[model samples]
Target: MGYQYQLTKVILVIIFWSLNEVIPIAWVFLICGASLPPLDLIISKDKYLAQFPWELYLFYGYAFYGILFQAEQHLIFLGIGYSLSRLVLYFQLKQSLNT
Candidate 1:
């Protein structure tokens, strides 16, 4: 298969995995499960002793670049949002450490 074909397949797989198409009843258990709270709150919450993982932002940079390079899609706003979030996380982490 060509690069575009492969990239499309990869994106489709990611979407499917995120949406829980891999298992018939997984979405209900994962997303619609009343026991579990929203994950965004946990991820975005500030921590006093814990350091944020900047590598995830780096992965996002890679994904944004990949989209731009392969699909000719210019997601400048998303890139800017990512950059701002990275800065916020960096400053928050810096302030958390006494050193």
Candidate 2:
């Protein structure tokens, strides 16, 4: 009975800790994904907006989150994902302009 109780407690602690770390990362990705399309539309409609350094602002925001949360790995992954998505958007916009 004692061993079983200890095992259960350990499992619960691990689960909760994992969730605490995961939930924020999941939220970041979810919000970024949801916002991208609308932002892309707005930027596309306004060529001058594309000239703005929006990506730098995003990087600063991500860096702020990292500083606040002390989650270096999450910040690195977020930066990579954001850069790739922005690159894709840039190429798509360039192509559209050419046509």
Candidate 3:
């Protein structure tokens, strides 16, 4: 199950990344942002939840397991790097949106 979960995440990320390149929409922020959904979408509670990506939870799971067990040394640094990168991306988007 663990192996399959990681494989699925890799595949999904690749697929979505490719899709984003083709679609040219800011869908990644809507799906992965730290902030609340846009005020207009407040009318539909379900829509906000639907936009939340479950893959993030899995990513956290992988990081936690890797760090706690110290089974995969690479995962810890990789996870930190990925998280920091995401943080920068999110804030950049937030600043742009605010302006």
- lDDT winner: 2
Give the TM-score (vs. native) of candidate 2. Answer: 0.40
Q: Report the backbone clash tally of model 3.
A: 0
lDDT of 3 by residue, 1-99 (tens): 465445545654665576676653444333323222222133334432333334456668887787687655444444444554555544555576579
Estimate candidate 2's RMSD in Å: 15.1
Each candidate: what lDDT? 0.45, 0.56, 0.48
Error of 1 at 65 (Å): 3.9
Assess every candidate by TM-score. 0.31, 0.40, 0.40
Q: How many angstroms is residue 26 displaced in model 2 relative to the true structure, after the best TM-score fit?
A: 5.9
**Per-residue alpha-carbon lDDT of candidate 1 for residues 7-63, written as tens digits (9 for 90 to 100):** 544554554467665555433233332211122223333431355645456647765
| lDDT for 9 (candidate 2) | 49
Clashing pairs in 1: none
Model 1 stretches with alpha carbons more than 4 Å out: 1-49, 60-64, 67-76, 96-99
